[model samples]
Target: MDSDMSMHASYAFKHTCWGILLLFLAGGVADCSVVVTVSGPHVAKVGSNVTLNVFITGATRPTIVWAMGDIPVVTWTLGSSSPPDILDPGGVLSIERDGSLSFHNVLLNYSATYTIRVVELGVGSNTSTFTLRVFERPSGDPMCSVTGVNGNQDLQYRCQWAGGTPEAQLSFPVLNATSSGSGDFNLTRKPSQDLNGKEVTCVASHPFLQRNCSVTARGPADFQPLVSSMVDADKKLVITIACASTSLPVATVTWSKGNQILTSGGRYQISSNTTLLFILDFHLNSTELGTYTCNAVNILGNQTNDVSVLGPTVSDLGLFPNQEGTMVTLTWETPRTSVITGFEVQMMGPSLLPSPGGRQRRKRATNEFGTIQEKPSSARSTNISGLDPKATYRFRVIPTAGATRGQPSKELRAGPGGGLSGPAIAGIAAGIPCGILLILIIIALIILCVVWRRKRRQTRYPVSRAVEKVVATQPNLNTPHTLLTGGLKTSAGPPDYSVHLASERSSTLPSVVSPPPVRMATTV
Candidate 1:
C-alpha cells in the first residue's frame, strides 16, 4: 500500500511540470508575430550608391535574408555573420549589422525586385519587398534644323536629343518637351522685319546631359546706285549718291570714291533709310570725278554699283547754208540750264589756215571767221560770214560751264549749192518733184471722184427747184403769175393767196388774184 501511494505522487508531479512548460512555449510563440519595416531606394542610377534595409518591430535581434526574385543575395544572424550568399560579382555589394544591403556602384544588371525576410528568436518569419530600377545618364548634344513656313513669313525649327538611357528634354523660346527615349521638338513663329540676321537657340536638358545649338538666318543679296550733282543753296557744288539693296540678312553698305573709302565726317556726310546716301561738297579734281562705288555686303553674298561724275551736255546742233551762198547759220540747244560760261564753235573748211607748229591753234575773237568763241548769248543761233563760195565745212560746238567743258556736239557738214553734195542734190531734186506731183495727182483724183459721186446721187434722187416769173406790167398792175417747172402736173383751183412780197415794192392795189397751188411728183 505505501509503495503504490509514492508512485502515484511522482507521476502527478511530473505532469504538473510538463503543463507549465507547454504554457510558457505557447506565450513565446504568440509574441513572435513580427511586423517587418523596409526602407531603401526604389530607383537608382548606374554608377551611384544605394542601400536597402530590413527591420522587425519590437525585436532586439533577428535573423535576416535579402534576396532578388527568390535568389538569396545576403543573410545575417543575430550573434554572428550570416552565411556568404553574394549575388553581385563586381565587388559593389555589402551588408550592414542592422540587416541592410548596400551597393557602392550600382549597375544596370542589378535592377530587380529585392525581398527581405526578418525572423526573431522563437518568432515567425516576416517579409518586405522593394522594386529597384537602374538607369544610365543621357549623352550627346541637341541638334536643330530650320525650315521656312507660311511662304517664308514664319520659321519652323525642329530640335532633336538622342542616344540616352532615358530620354532627355528639349526646349526653345516658344516650346518645351519631355521624352523618355529620344526627344524631338518643333516651334514656329512669324518673323519680324528686323528679325533677319537674328539667332535662334535650342536647349536640351537631361539628368546627365545639357546642351545648346544655334543658327543664323540668310540675308541681303543685291544692290543698285544712283548719282547726281548740282549747285546747292549755299552755292557750293554738291554731289549726291545713293544706294538701294535687296537682302534678307540686312546688308552692310559702304561707299568708296576712287581709291578712298568714304565715311561720315568733314565734307563727307552720310545718311540712310532703305536707301543709303553720301553727300559731299564738290572738289573738281580728276580723282573726285572718278568712278564711285557702293558696296553692299551680307552673309549670303555681296553686290556693287558704280557711277562717274561728269559735266552737262548739249544736243541738236545744226547748220544750214542760205540760198545766196553768202554765209552759214548754226543752231544748238542746251540740255540743262546749269551755269554756262560760254560756247566754243569751230569750223574746219577746205581753205584752212596753218599755225606756227603745224598744230591747229585756238582762234581768238578776231582770228578767223570760221571759228567763233563768243560770250553766252540769249539767242542760240549764229551766222558765220567771209566763207569762200565753193568750199566745204565741218562745224561743231562745245559748251563750257564753271571749270568743266562738255563733250563736243555732233558735227554738221555744210557747203555751197543748197548745203548738199552732187548726189544729195540730185536725190533731193528728183524726190521733191515726185512727191509734189504725187500729191497733186492724189488731190485731183479725189476731187474728180467726189464730183462724179455727187452727180450720180443727184441723178438717182433728183430734187426740184422753184422758178420765178416777172411780167412787163408788173410794176403798174398787181397780178399773180405762176410759172410751171419740172415734169410735174399742176391742177389750178380758186386762187390760193399765200405769196409774200418784199416791203420795198409799192403795192398800188390792196387786193389781187392769188397764185394756184402746184403739185410735184416724188422720185425714187
Candidate 2:
C-alpha cells in the first residue's frame, strides 16, 4: 500500500508540469503576433519641421525601419544606446527612439509615400504607411481684372493667383461664385444703372494663406467737345459743335443755350446720334450767339462742357515794322456794320519806372492794357511810332460800339529790337534762304541763256533757210505780213519796241484792274 501511493503522487506531479509548460507556450505565441499602429498621412509645409509618430503594440525590443518610395531612409533598434542609422546622404531625416520619423526643414522632393516597419525580436514584423505632402503658400494677393462683354451689357470679372503646389481656390463674394480648379476665377453679370460706382471683390484661399483683390464699377468719364465755325456758299455764317464721352453703357448728349434747350428745328440741326449740333444760316444780329452747353448724362454721372459763340469783331489783324524797327503799323479788318462805332488798340509792356527799392526788379507782365488809342470806324490801319525798339510789347484790338466793348482779338507778341513781330522775324528768316535760292536760279538761267545764244548762232542760217522755204509754200494773206520775233507769234505785225519811248512822253496809262470788294457781315 505505501508503494502504490508514492507512484500515484509522481504521476500527478508530471501531469501538472506538462499543463504549465503548454500554458507558457500559448502565451508566448500570443505575444509574438506583433502589431504596429501609427498616425499616418502626414502633411507639412515647405521649410517646416514635422514628425510622423508610430504607436507599436505587442513588440519587444522593436527594430524600426523607415522607407520612402522603395528607398530606405532610416533604421534603428529601439532602446539601443547607439544613434539611429540614417540612410539619407543629406542627413535631413532622423528617427527617434520611439520609432518616430523626423524631418528637419522638409522639402518638396521629400513628399512621397513612406513606410514604417516595426519588428519585434523573435516575433513577426508589421508595417504602417504614411503619405507626406509638401505644400507652398501663395506669394501675394490675387489680382483682379474687369472687362465688358455682350455689347457692353455685362461685365466680366477675373481673378488669378499663380505658383502654388495645388492651385489656390478663388471666389467672388458679390456673385457667390467659386473657381473650378482652372487656375483662374471668372464671373459675369449684367450691370444695372443703379449699380454704377459699385465695388467688386475677389478672394483666394489656400491651406497656408489667403488673399483678395477688388475693383470699382463706374460710368461716364472723360468728356470732350469741339467747336468750330465757317461761312457757307450763301454768305451765311454756320456754327458746328461735337461732343463725346466715355462710359460703360454709352451716354446721352444734350445741347442748351442759357436756360433754353435746343433741338433740331429751323436753324438748329442735331445729328441722329445726338453728338453733333449745327446752327444753319447763323445771323450775327439774331439771338444765336451765347454760351452753348453740352451735357452728357449716363447712369453713373453727368458731365458738361461750355462753348461760347460771339458776333464778328476783328479779323485778319496784321503787324508790320519799319526797317529801323522804331515804328509799327497795325492793320485789321471788320465787317462793315453800324454796331461797331470804332476800335481801340491796346498795348502792354514792361513798366518804365524803377521799383522803390532802387533796383529794376523784373515784374510779372500782365495782360492789362497800358497804352490805349481809339481809331475811327472807317480807318483800317494805324501807325504806332515813338516806341522803344529794345522793349518787348504785346498788342490786342478791342471793338467798341459807343460805350460797350466787344470781344478782344487774340494777343500778338513783339520781341525786343524795335517792334520786330513774330511774323516779321519769320519772314526775315525765310527770306534769307529764299534770296540764296533765287540767286542760284538766276545764275543757272544766265548760263542757260548764254548756251542758248551760242546754239542759235550755230543754227541761225539753217533755221532761216527752212523758214523761207515754208513761207514760199504757204498761202498769201490780204493783211500785212507778220513776223515771229522774240520767240512770240503775234496776229498783228511785230510790236515796235520804240513805241514804248513815245508812250513815256505821254501820261502813264491807267490801271484797268480794280481791287476786289470786301464782303462784310451784319453785326448786332
Task: Name the candidate that leads on lDDT.
Answer: 2
**Any residue pairs clashing in model 2, and if so which?**
389-418
**Which portions of model 2 show Cα errors greater than 4 Å?**
1-33, 81-83, 89-91, 150-153, 176-182, 221-524
TM-score of each: 0.33, 0.38
Give me the overall lDDT of model 2.
0.71
Instruction: Report the lDDT tens digits of candidate 1 across residue range 1-524.
Output: 99987876675455444433333343335344677777887778899999887666766676666767756666556557445445454788788777778888888888888877665656565667889888776555788766666655566667787656567777775333432224787776565544465666787777655788875555554544555455566766666676766554455678787788888788777775424554545666675666777787654456877766555456688887788655789999864323344677887765443434677653332323254556462448788765556665677887665456678787777664436656777999899989999999999999999999998876454333431333332454354444434444455764333432443255565577775654555675
Residue 253's lDDT within candidate 2 is 84
Which residue pairs show collisions in model 1? Answer: 167-180, 219-248, 219-249, 220-247, 220-248, 220-249
Q: Which digits, one per residue and each the tens of the lDDT, describe model 2 over residues 457-484?
A: 7632223455556668876787656563
Q: What does each candidate score in C-alpha RMSD?
A: 29.7, 37.2
What TM-score, to 2 decimals, does candidate 2 have? 0.38
